[model samples]
Target: MLTQTRNVEEKLYFNRFVVDAGRPHITVRPHERPSAELRSLTHMCPAGCYSQNEAGQVEIATDGCLECGTCRIVTARTGEVEWNYPRGGFGILYKFG
Candidate 1:
């Protein structure tokens, strides 16, 4: 019998981010309608991935935003999110994910 040798030191990519339903308020309201128009019309949509700021402005989730760049371009008044730096340099690192 022989054991296979492998490199122990390496940077591994962990994809498949588990999107939590979060609290009841975080999840889509029961009466909410899933609309394609809404997805296209807003930077963050009513889906509320990145929450709104104190002034009712959307806060950017650039780190895990999938880089759609919609946060800056979307003309929606409520969904204009600002970017946040990667916390402690630990954030979403896309590696073919």
Candidate 2:
């Protein structure tokens, strides 16, 4: 049998929502994605999605995620990570979402 692997062992030095990818060639990598351009996005997650991660940073994810610069540009700079995006062609297929 073949051995396993490590995909995205660390998202940030802290505040990790995903970890231990447990398989080689599984197509995983740390992605610092660009923020969305949808202007409708406004409020941050008051429910605390960031606290759920390994670290206590939660300014990202798909809740009321406004696609504004809430999580990526600003939150990332302050080091209060709380986000993850769906794989391309997957997750919420928003025709108008």
Candidate 3:
């Protein structure tokens, strides 16, 4: 079987991208609270958008998000992650296309 040839973020770094500043499309509830279910999103998000802050709070940096919906799917059980698509013309854009 083939291994993960490259780190997820490393690969996403090569693609063209755009980030909106106003509001994040993805958000975590109970800002200071921690959840085992949501914590796993840090490893599952392909773009490495989900992570824990120094305070141990779940942080969702949507800029690099690949919009893969993996985070939404993983956190669906708890309904704590607010997931939605970015407004039109926002978020990632592939350069080659």
Candidate 4:
């Protein structure tokens, strides 16, 4: 049997995201800006949904989120993030295993 191999980006292309406008499932607390946990999210998130703003504050855009819960785990004890599942039918849809 011939198997196909795909890179991370390529595999990710098979996934689809349904964004919930005006109702982001994940948000960075403004009061928690510039924290070590938030900073770590910038690089730790597999979907790259977290980033550092010009003012050195962490920000989140939930559109392309893989919903892997990395952010939640990283900031769970810090109270620096708000994490939840998107509304039903709005979130990542994995096309392949």
Best by TM-score: 4
lDDT of 3 by residue, 1-97 (tens): 8765666556656776667787889888875676787888888777788888888888887877778888788877888899899889888875423
Give the lowest summed-lDDT range of ten residues in model 1: 22-31
Clashing pairs in 3: none
The lDDT ranking, best first, is 4, 3, 1, 2
Over the full model, what C-alpha lDDT does candidate 3 score relative to the true structure?
0.79
Each candidate: RMSD: 11.3, 16.2, 5.0, 1.3
Identify the superior model by lDDT, candidate 2 or candidate 4: 4
- Which regions of candidate 1 deviate over 4 angstroms? 1-63, 75-79, 85-88
**Steric collisions counted per model:** 0, 7, 0, 0
TM-score of 4: 0.91
Candidate 3 residues lying further than 4 Å off, grouped into runs, are 1-11, 95-97
For each candidate in the order shown, give its overall lDDT on alpha carbons: 0.35, 0.32, 0.79, 0.88
Indicate whether candidate 1 or candidate 3 has the larger TM-score: 3
* Model 1, C-alpha of 33: deviation from truth (Å): 18
Give me the runs in candidate 2 sitting further than 4 Å from their true place. 1-69, 82-84
